[model samples]
Target: MAELLKAGAVFFVGFLALYLLIVLVVWLGQERMIFQGHVLPQHYAFSFKADFEEYSIPAADGAILNALLFRSDSSSRGVVLYLHGNRGNLSRWGHMHRPFTQRGYDVLLIDYRGYGKSTGKPTESGLYQDGEAALQWLLQYYEARKIIIYGRSLGSGVAAYLAARNPHQLLILETPYDALTNVIQHQALLPLPGCIFRHHFPTYRYLPAAEGPIYILAGSHDRLIPLYLSKRLQPLIGTPENFKVIQGAGHRNLAAFQAYHFELDRLLLP
Candidate 1:
């Protein structure tokens, strides 16, 4: 009996130490988990186009952020401030603006501080500053009502943060998680205490104060973030009717489907 108790105590101590170690790892590397920016060298000249104008918006921390203003030839409905996901730079993401620009809505796609031709590192608070700076830069060229904020994946958090603070024509979020806290907890394989995270992009908290029509687009089969997370956020913005589920769509391939365009029409057109 004594031997069994000793073994049990040793096992308990080992498990406890391992659990604490995991918590420590989460604390040290949470930023990497949240942000996956593909950085570019400073002053990297973006390719010029006939209709596009590249920008180097200044941030509070002296970071030169990279962005592009994709112009629409037809009568402009508004400009979409396109905030992309956690991964990749504007070079790859620029292709996505066609869905908006082809429909006469210009696109303003920007990279987070470290991504694309932008300089400086990425932080949650700093991203909010970058987002605001982008919005202010856009407002300089167009009226406040002519700007529509669109965020997908990680960018949705930044978009929600911006829309909550600024006035815009509309706020469209695609495949957005409820909060960074929720995302960490949901993705945690074990029942770990992921609630004490540092990077809290509280989209649910921001949506309440946002001044625009909030259109939430979620995928029916998104494994990275479940569809119900988007459903949960709908009540915070408006009725469940505002939550539009694009069938057969996942997190990354949402733009590849025609249903994605259909929903954009619902928000962009009357």
Candidate 2:
């Protein structure tokens, strides 16, 4: 019986060691999992069919952030400062400007640090600073009332952060979460300490401080950021009319849904 007890103690120690190792690995690799930015060459030329002018905004940290401003063909209603997700550069996301530009709203989409032509590494605070720089640049041409802040997936946190501090015409979030920790915890293989996460983009914490109407759209079938996670944000800034759910839609395919376009038309059209 003493031998069996000793063996059990050894097993427990081994298991604990393995668990700690896994936690360490996850902690170290959190940035890669969170910010999957695609880097572009400095000399890379963007060729889009849309009427767009490129921009090079200087960040506070001496990083040069690259952006694309797609102008509306018709009379401009306002401008949309679109903060994209964690994947790919402006080349992959630039096509999305059509939805806004077609509706007479010029779209200004900027890449975060180390994404596309931008310089330096990306952090939660760094992303916020990049967003602030973009907002200031947009304000140079348009008033705060004519600016709409649109955030998608990973960008939702930054959008909420900016909206909380600055004045904007509207705040639109797609596939947002209450916080970045909520997303990691929901998808984690083993329960992780919040400290393991380097970036905690607490959209819930920022939403209450936001001025004006906030609209949150989520796909019912979004496995990446499940509807429940997005639903957690509704109570922060949602009315029955503000929080929208697109049925049978997944995380990446909301634009394919007519219901999504209907909502956009209602919100964007004059």
Candidate 3:
């Protein structure tokens, strides 16, 4: 009996070690799995009434990022610097073009590194650097204009980091996670201790430092990011009125919610 117990203990230790190794690999390579390219379908394309241009902005690490700039025909009330989710490129945000453009807001949608035509591997810091570079490009090129920063999902962390660094005209985060670590813990169902999770995109940590107005939108049924996470972060926001929860919507379907459309219109419209 004693011998059998000792063998069991050894086997358990070995299994734990192997499990941890697998987790580390998954954590490091999560971006590759999460951010597969989504090619733009020609059927969904729309004609641009105003002058639209594509740009290749250089990141801080010297990576060239692909971006689309949509300018309104008339004087725009403000410009929206859009950081999209992990799955697709700027073209995927084509659905958002008419709504924002019709409101007379210029939108700059960018494809993060490793997504779409941008070069370089996707990492937590790499995305942040890409956002900063995009913001700098907008600031330098579109001077004397109001700028609103908008992000969804993973892009929310990048937007929050930028909001902390610079005073944006406004900050809008949709279906954002509290932190990357929390997201991994919830999704992976890992039993490992918190000390081992290293990728920290702590949007909560930077929220307080944001000097401008912030609008946080979350879905009640968001499977990817739990509603409770957004609920927990809501009180931590600089202003409580900025937070909103979309009813009966999940992470991907929030855009279809009429309340979401109304809130977006209220926030982004002149």
Query: What are the per-model C-alpha RMSD values against the true structure?
Result: 2.3, 1.9, 3.9
* lDDT assessment of candidate 1: 0.85
Task: List the lowest-lDDT window of 10 residues for candidate 1.
Answer: 42-51
Residue by residue across 41-134, what tens digits does model 2's lDDT show? Answer: 9999998887789999998888889999999999999999999999999999999998899899999999999899999999999999999999
Model 2, residue 122: C-alpha shift (Å): 0.3
TM-score versus the correct structure, for each prediction = 0.90, 0.94, 0.84
Sort the predicted structures by lDDT, highest score first: 2, 1, 3
lDDT for every model? 0.85, 0.93, 0.80
Q: Name the best candidate (by lDDT).
A: 2
Sort by TM-score, top down from the best = 2, 1, 3
Model 3 CA deviation exceeding 4 Å by range: 1-25, 37-51, 143-145
lDDT of 1 by residue, 166-250 (tens): 9899888999988876777677644567555778888999999998688899999998888877777988886568788999999
Clashes of each: 0, 0, 0
Judging by TM-score, tell me the better candidate of 2 and 3: 2
